[model samples]
Target chain A: MTQVIVTVMPKQGVLDPQGQAVAGALGQLGFDGVGEVRIGKRIELSIAGDDPAGQARAMCEQLLANALIEDYTVEVGA
Target chain B: MSTTVAVLRFPGTLDHDSAVRAVEGLGATAVEAWHADAALPAGTDAVLLPGGFSYGDHLRCGAIASRAPIMGAVRRHAEAGGRVVGICNGFQVLCEAGLLPGALRRNSTLSFVCRQMELEVADDETPWTPGLETGAVISIPIKNNEGAWYGDAGTARVVLRYRDNLLGSTDAVAGVANAAGNVMGLMPHPEEACDALLGSTDGQIVLAGLIA
Candidate 1:
């Protein structure tokens, strides 16, 4: 069995209002040194596989992330 | 032959009734096609992807719904030069499905914009805007959380422009037609604007262009 972790985030130069709102809230709560916070999602999958990396990459491209405004990274581990 | 437009229904799709009503009001037959179904109704002259939070907007708005089985039929339909129109969330799905260019992202204001807006007809020759004169402004309701239109400037022919530049869309684009001019996706609810009771019939001109 292997674990695949996928991370998805909006591509640079695309507006991310949710991330901005969270950054604003963080500032309101007295957090410091947060410059341009960008938010994204992480998905973890457990699979019994011959090639989990390939499967994970296909998932990200076909379903997990939208290539138009988002970029995704997939990491497979034992 | 009379036109029949298929209105695709995904789980959580909220505006099917109004979309069907608008199409029917235009004297065409409107049929509801389920998301899981692999085919649209026979004789589907056009397809209308109505607005709503499909799959509860999971993954991303329109991401999950874009993979539905009926989309295969949509792709083939468009390939055969059939007309397709997507409104609001439907616009998001079309982008995700790759039937149209660009992706709709969160509004710059970080708030759901729900109001009547004026859109200039940037391209009057599209399948959904023949009656509209170039540069003519039409009023309609636009409501969405992730309605910002983004795309490559050279690839997208701006079909409409907002009077006040709502949502910070690139080039004030309110809508766009595919390079073939057969498919269009826009951020406004032209269906909800099809009646005098809605305080405007400007959307009729757009919808009427579909069947004409």
Candidate 2:
């Protein structure tokens, strides 16, 4: 079985209200030097395939992420 | 002939009844369609994606629901020129489904806004707003946490605009129509305002726009 991790984050130009709210809370807690924060989702998948990267890409494009507003990266586990 | 509007019910959908009643009240037939079903009800003239947290809003609001098997039918339907309207959460689904442009980011206020809002008619020729004159302002209920409409709206026409930019949407767009004018997605709940009990029948004008 091949394990892969997919990370989906909003595109640079998209507004991320939730991330902004979290960043605000971090500032209130006195976290210094935090410049920008963007929110995103991560999905881990285990599949039986020789090309886990291909499967991961399909998942992200078809269901795991909205390409219109999000960018995704996939990592394969050894 | 009476038109039949398919009211889709996803697992987390909570407002299908209002959509049904709104269509029936206008003398059209309302058929219940399921998200798991790969096909729409036979002879469905239009489809209404109602409000609710589909799939418990996992990943993102409307993200999962947009991939439902039934959306295939919806895409085919829209491609063939069938009318479709997504309201509130439904609007999010349409955007996620790629039937419309943009994403509905969390509201700038970070609160679930639930109240009556005034929408100015930006386009008067779409499937869901033809009954109203351009620049006509109508009252309807706006409710949702991720209600801020984002995206360029592409070549699709803007059908409605919030009078005050309540959710900080780009261009203050409250609703948009496909370039073909058959599919629409809006943040406001026009179905919820179709009766006097909801404090306005002005919404009937919007729904009737589909059938008329």
Candidate 3:
């Protein structure tokens, strides 16, 4: 069966306070060149075909990724 | 009146038993509501968003589960000041559902917190909290990875208060009542504690109050 996977991350222009906090702490620990950090999730699903990928993407866009807060990418997996 | 309670189950909930136990122990007829379903059975006086890794907490805690079909009903129920609640991850759902304000951020200490904590009910007005005094101390189990409650200063002040506890100085908010004064979302597990077998039997009173 074909599988579809969706990856979601905090959208650009969103406040990733947690990621920012981590970057700040890293700088305090003497690390350099770490400009940005963002958190995201990876989800894999087993579905039938490309049609389901569209369905799954719609689900991600409407429900999974808060477009105002997050971005998402959908891909097909083996 | 003898009331009806519904426990919402989505794609990724754990701890289903104890939640049902809490409802049954409280004397409410218990039923399970699926996330894919929209309408609640007629006469469900209260709804329980039991704790779990619901929808795997995608996008943020409770963010995903809040979009389930049942959540729309939850939001509407709460809008009418119906009794709806969340515990732990469920609390996160309540926030995401907009039944309440504020959000559950990652623990400030960056750790999963699990401990017996004292709770003082802020107000007795909410049906969910009638059994506890405005500042009564009740112990319940706490377990969550992202249970830190946060919001703006004004919002935080209004949303939560530190309560005086004989057990310790717990913030006035062991739990919170939404604006409508019916919906509640808290971080502790009254379900787990409803039986002496789990810990304190005091949880029964808390659950009982909701069905009251």
**Residue clash pairs of candidate 2:** none
For candidate 1, the lDDT comes to 0.89
User: DockQ-based ranking, best first?
Assistant: 1, 2, 3
lDDT of 1 by residue, B18-131 (tens): 999999998999999999999999888999999999999998889999999999999999999998999998999998999888888888888999999999998877867776
- Assess the local accuracy of residue B23 in candidate 3 as a C-alpha lDDT between 0 and 100: 82
Q: Which candidate would rank higher by DockQ, 1 or 2?
A: 1
TM-score of 1: 0.96
Clash tally for model 2: 0
What CAPRI grade goes to candidate 3? incorrect
Residue by residue across A1-78, what tens digits does model 2's lDDT show?
Answer: 888999999999888887888999999999977878998988989988789899999988888888877999999997
Residue lDDT tens for model 2, B1-212:
99999999999998999889999999999999999999999989989999999999888899999989999999999999888999988989998988988888888898989999999998887767655789999999898998888878556589999998878898898998878888999989988898898799878888886584
Q: Chain B of model 3: TM-score?
A: 0.87
Cα lDDT tens digits for candidate 3, B1-212: 67888888988888677888778877778889999998887888888888999978766788888878888888787777777878888888887776776666665445666777766555666666554556666777778777656543344323223343211112434566666667777777888888777779766766765674
User: Chain B, model 1, TM-score against the native?
Assistant: 0.97
TM-score of each: 0.96, 0.95, 0.73
Q: Which window of 10 residues has the lowest lDDT sum in candidate 3 chain A?
A: A61-70
